[model samples]
Target: MDVEDDNSYETSTLQVLELKTGDSLRDAIGLLYEKNVFGAPIADVIDSATTSGNFLDPYIGFIDFATMVLWSLEIGELAKSFLWDPFFPVHLNDTLFHVLLLLSKHRIQFVPVIEQFSSKVIAFVTQNAVIQLLLQSSGLEWFDSIADKPLSEFRFENDEHAVHLYGDQSIAEAMHILWENRIGAVAVVRRETERLIGCVTRSDLHLLLDNDDIFNNRKSLTVEKFIHLEASKVHSDPTIEGDLGALLSAGILTLKNKFLPRMDSPVTNRRTDTLKQTMKNLAETNCSSSFIVDELQRLKGVVTLRDMIVQFAPPCMDSRINGGGFFDSALEQTGCHIEKGTLVSDH
Candidate 1:
């Protein structure tokens, strides 16, 4: 039941996307691309095709575009199937600050909000959603103290070296960098002036699935050409091969429309912009990350959704033992396979 009070939130019904074990790499990518979602849970396969669980426990693990792209770029042709990563999940009783810490530390998109009694996942609260809740606190003293501060006032560890590529660089090369660096997007700059010209994000890579023309001519296509294609496409010289798998596959859910989630135009910020202001821009643009640039439009640093969420957490020392960044290393240390993704626990 929903609380009618203006301050309370309700655990309402939701339609969550699910990836199956049988979904090929391309199939999963196309699903995410089609849905315009960053990540989703893999549906559990069992004797009966009915949904099962504590409250509604039918999912095994979760996966996202960033990890999927990384896998496609490196671990090709293993028939390697993937699924659930045991990530930090939240209970109804858990405090917001606790959830914020887990999100900031794990750098995850959504934290599973499970029922306290049956442990069924009732919600997958997203970073953007949480940020929206915080934005509601704009007038509060505690929130204002942090939001009013400029970007320079906050600490950005390892932010100076944002991954980037030149306009002349091939789209293939950009994909390789995204795979190698474990990043979602890269800045495209003019080689001569090093000015921010455009941005090539993980979302842009979906062109390979949506447009057979792009997959056919990926080699000769430059980053600049790729960005241009987003606006008005011109196919490259036809080649023998086309897209890897059937771009359109029957998934648990149907695809929406062919609309790109992220755009080539770089949503940016400056050193002087306050946290409150930057958050507004990010929300307005529906962008996960923003490039901080100088007066000359040269890239200075980048601010991400994770960067914003972490800012709200109470000040503390880095507690990670092995420089815990992404879950890749953690999985390796535990000998976990692609199917058995990693999950973090606050305990």
Candidate 2:
């Protein structure tokens, strides 16, 4: 494939959800939920002397919904809480190679693209978007070989140390577990059977933020309860608001409504499944990770996008480095520590 210089590329016109410095964490999260986004760029409201038009100061950093959840749990306040420092941003003129390096290094879903001088965010790039680009590019067949390998070979130490949550646990407790472990999602299993019941993700926590009743009563609510409540909303008939109202009024809405069917039946693969098959499943569903299970459907570990991408770094670097000088210089500009084409180490 022919490589193009960074200057020839244009910033994406996708409207980014920019957050102000004073935006409450709850409000920020609600916006994320409304938009179904993982994060947003944070800009400070500022004044410029040269122009009459208002301009936002350089973005401080990016705030992730997951980070917001952690902060809320930490301070025991959501509506009044605010995010502190955000993650680093990439320049708008940076090549795709540079953005990939930053994403891998930071283990984030997306990176904010800022103007070189003004540091103002112009757009953002996402891991899924980059992955799609690679899928359409030449030499994608290279993944065919890598995908044939067993997941066990790619499993890392942290994957072996999988953190879990019991269905009976409180939502507050579940949030703490996810925050403490710094993971995007956790497996929820039955207390007695240890059977995988459902999964709770950082995005799922947004349900609490969207509803005041649930958030205020979180202490008395179980993780299962939260999951079931969200699931009901997802499956409920929008035209029949009266049914939902009656259920809520009667206090009969319970876990029996079923967990969010999507989360309830987690996307999974066997430990022995080929990487190619796993990747295909993940891509088809647009999910970030899948539960690696044993023959009996018992959870063995988790396979995430970061893990798969890290495994592909060696080959990706070789492709880019050999593509020509333009690609080589772009990779070098990323300032990512590298040895023999592979990433130095996981972030």
Candidate 3:
């Protein structure tokens, strides 16, 4: 692959996924609502998607209702259909161009990848994955230049496995699965035939987090039941404009009704040594972040150089002008006196 040095490239070592970069998370959210991916208005999705009986912090938890949403308009309907095959799935062995084709067709960000023979879901080929793969493939000789170590010793690879949930499950039920597994996404399956309904992501939950109504509303509902109510219905009728209106009116809809790019393209990084090797992987693939998966193709977590900086370095050295207890200073600049950290709420 020819390495082009565009503005998106960082030090000839990394590339940022710029497709969605200039776009604001807020605007993307509004587009999702307008398009009806959540099956209701922003407020309704928030209300419908929240859990009722939980109190992580009482006051603090309530504010979770204001969390930012992350629904991508790029991944939509066909993405949802792929979600319905309990076993049939999009896989990772495909290519970047192929993945782009899937997204072009459906507008989904996360697509489930399955094993060929057993027809079992194994891994997810996220948009981020394709970009990272692109970046990783850019640096092929990093490992070959190193002595004796197998490339597999350091690089991350997809095991091609999946974590699943029933299509009839409630939002709260999905929440529990996500929380317990420390994962940000889940796959939904139907009740009778165990067909795939669709997949959900942390972005979806974040969108729901903005609604306060869900807390009081779901007190009596199970998560499985709640999600099932939203994801169970699938519409074969085609038309983004009309479908958007319906979903915006309700709380859930099928993935096929939305826009999702790329389905089952897998690209690989032939192993490399050192953190730079990782950076090379990211740059070649044009991904902002990449996952670290185990041999079983299950996700371990993600590793991004951005994350690396936040982890190892102190706040001041990172060139973040808003660093160095800046929020405290801004509050002080407002001339507010604090007797403790508590401010007197305005009556």
Candidate 4:
């Protein structure tokens, strides 16, 4: 079904690694770690790598999370073989239900949108962006009404503006770009076409700040050395403790001791689970997001805290009144138990 002249794009593993397929993922991570990579997951890697040296003793409470970055899958492999295609990407200009349908069917976080003429990826639509759109569409502070109108009413329309850095730019240069722009994320662009090559997030810069890596001296550091010394790490797995408060408290403590910022970790749910089971996970984690992946471990779709708010709020059932960021307040007003490990309840 691919149009040879479509000029859109065919997935290329080589393009992904920024090199040939024969190269290892480890090598790719190492290379980029020396330069840049972004997004939430990669943030975890940069954190671990930069602080590995100082935070060595766990028992002494000097542990660091960035030290645990791990290259589970090779960059080349990830590029050539994604769960979904990048060329035929999800359009950001779509309805909520439609977005939901795509997420459910494709099981992806980001879908690359290619320009029809160039077939080059022009932009990306991610789950986070969609959630923001959903929240905006509701207009109600609480977004309690699940079945409202189509989501396109809240489609994204904005001038292109992004902080950017080049592929071979020094980490110090990346840091300067962020500081000057007063932004946390920067697009790593191809110098010639100004196309997005990758990203360098606040988390990536955090590594530089936390490590006190002097830009002047970094010249002696090779890409391999930087990645091996600062970028290699493994992702953290959230444990299911019977007590929600205990779990959160423990997680917070781990973050503090490890000098890693806390983030919403992934969670799983039984599709057939009771409403009670669903609420329990939501309360304990406060993230309001549960990724619905499949048996193959591919992304299904996402459920937000706001989605549940609409289902339970009484005001939402009555009429379409704007709640104005009142989902948390409404939850409390209704006497829903938000505290960790509390039984599900609605006043």
lDDT of every predicted structure (CA atoms):
0.63, 0.60, 0.35, 0.36
TM-score to true structure, per model: 0.72, 0.70, 0.28, 0.30
Kindly list the per-residue Cα lDDT of model 4 for residues 79-162, writing each as its tens digit: 423221122243334334444444433334434443444333444444433343343344463343332422222111111233
Clashes of each: 6, 2, 73, 20
Ranking by lDDT: 1, 2, 4, 3
Model 1: per-residue Cα lDDT at residue 24: 78
CA lDDT, candidate 4, residue 174: 56
lDDT of model number 2: 0.60
* Local lDDT at 113 for model 4: 41
Tens digit per residue, CA lDDT, model 2, 176-284 = 8888887878888778877777788776766676688878887778877666664444543323432232222111111122222356766788777876667655544
Model 4 poorest ten-residue lDDT run: 57-66
Model 4 bad stretches (over 4 Å): 1-23, 39-88, 91-98, 139-143, 147-347
Candidate 1, residue 301: lDDT: 84
Ranking of predictions according to TM-score? 1, 2, 4, 3
Q: Say which prediction, candidate 1 or candidate 4, comes out ahead on lDDT.
A: 1
Model 2, 65: alpha-carbon shift in Å? 3.4
Better of 1 and 3 by TM-score: 1
